[model samples]
Target: MYVVKSPLPDADLKTVADALQGALVDLVDLALVAKQVHWNVVGPRFRSVHLQLDEVVDSARTHSDTVAERASALGVSPDGRAATVAAGSGISSAPAGWVKDSDAVGALADALGAVITRMRQRIASTAEPDPVSQDIFIAVTADLEKHHWMFQAENA
Candidate 1:
């Protein structure tokens, strides 16, 4: 009756894998939202904001792949379905229709920060501790922080 394969040991690997899956979901959602904003953005700073959104989405997509691959390495099937991701992600849903460039950037930055925080917490909670998880969290956190700063700078 099991739809998804069982996860690895109930140890740090499993914990990191589970957390990676959650991070994957958040990244996928954030990527989609970034692209949505990128395509729909208008106004004076349209070109700049749209380009930035593209960069963010690309980074999110890369992170998603890394996270999913990590999950698979831990003996778990990666849940890449939209419904599953949407249900698992802690990131807020994007509003309908065209949104202001600033609003879109703000929303994406907030989501990225939240995901990075969650990843940090999970990485800290690992019992046996995996270096890969720590490495991934550190890399992702730096990327998210950069994006957050870039978004904030746009407002300045």
Candidate 2:
């Protein structure tokens, strides 16, 4: 059942793999949530909110790829399937139906907050076992935090 071999001991690999998988699921779900809002967002600020949602989607997609690739490189199979994301993601489900501009902003900010919280935990968990993975978590956290700030500002 071992397709690839990881350099780290079983204990370290397990910790790193768990963090990577969690990050992958969250990022995938985050992208899906943002895209859902982008398509359904309505209201006076729709244009700007719509565009902002795309930025979040793009960043999530990019970070998910990086995390997945890192997992693969470390000999762990990354599962980004819809079922996996639905079952394992830390992000809450997006609201169904048309989302108002303000609602969309709030939703994304909240989703990003959830993901960032887990990302911080991952960052800490991976710090000693795998600084490489920790670095990725840090970068991803920075981007998600920036998006959260922008979305919160939209409500201001």
Candidate 3:
């Protein structure tokens, strides 16, 4: 049964909903990965890397909420369950334990890159169907790209 009605046509809603759901999955996974790395990171740059990881976790969580709310507003349910994220996230798996600071940096950089890439795709796809959602995607991509650049600089 449909509780909320979407403003967009069915076809457009499908595309926008898919994009929002994918974003929620990736953002949730990104926060989890950053937290895991923050806990296990070791080495000379531990302090800096650990702090940076927290920033990523915060951003991911904040943005995930925004994406989910946007989906809800569009009459789509956002799924960010662990199973959904594990199955659909664009991010790769984190190491089991004791990740080196450098590795953690690299991993997060890669994670942000993955999310940003998909977000860009979503932005393009939603431009015509749902410019509002497209705007969210653009903002999210910009934020993730900043973290990605910082992490890459860490390795430089």
Candidate 4:
């Protein structure tokens, strides 16, 4: 396990680090779910939805890496265990079986939005705040909001 020591207050760093790890876990799970939808989605708008899902999943992966790196920078090992992430993630599990393309898109968007909200809260609460983590959250949130808008547009 690699840890990077920080000069910030121990309690603040520990709390922010834990939150960052938790957010990373959620991001990983959400990324996997988005990819699952991307691969399985089928319908008239398959091409469009498929491409959008791919983009969203890619963004999630990028943000997850950044968040995990931030945690390591703060002297904490980022959580990568599937079970740990599933347990900590606020995103709901996808149902067993193929879902309609629209529903899949909606589900993924909802999960990502929930994560974005949580990340925003955590970023604001960090005491000797990590700017890198905050920036990652900002970027991820914008991507998620775009995903949400796209999915909603598909429904309209």
TM-score of 1: 0.87
- Comparison by lDDT, 1 against 3, better one: 3
What's the number of clashes in each of the models?
Answer: 0, 0, 0, 0
Candidate that beats the other on lDDT, 2 or 4, i.e. the better one:
2
Please write out the lDDT profile of model 3 over residues 1-156, one tens digit for every residue. 447898899999999999999999999999999999999999999999999999999999999999999999888888988899999999889888899999999999998999999999999999999999999999999999999999999999
Per-residue lDDT over 1-156 for candidate 1, one digit per residue giving the tens place of the 0 to 100 score: 234544434676567767778888888988987887787887778899999998889899998898887777666778889899879888877757887877877777777777778877766755346666667867876887789789878876
- Give Cα distance to truth, residue 115, candidate 2, Å: 0.1
**Which scores greater on TM-score, model 1 or model 4?**
4
Q: What is the C-alpha lDDT of each candidate?
A: 0.78, 0.96, 0.94, 0.78
Indicate the residue-level lDDT of 117 in model 3: 91
Evaluation by lDDT, superior candidate among 3 and 4: 3
Candidate 4 per-residue C-alpha lDDT over 63-146 given as tens digits, one digit per residue, 9 for 90 to 100: 889888877777888887988987899888865567688788778768877887887787676624666666766776777778
Q: What's the lDDT of the predicted structure labeled candidate 2?
A: 0.96
Residue 134, model 2: Cα distance from true site in angstroms: 0.3
Candidate scoring better on TM-score of 3 and 4: 3
Backbone clashes in model 4, listed as residue pairs: none
Per-residue lDDT tens digits for candidate 2, residues 1-156, read: 567888889999999999999999999999999999899999999999999999999999999999999999999999999999999999889999999999999999999999999999999999999999999999999999999999999999
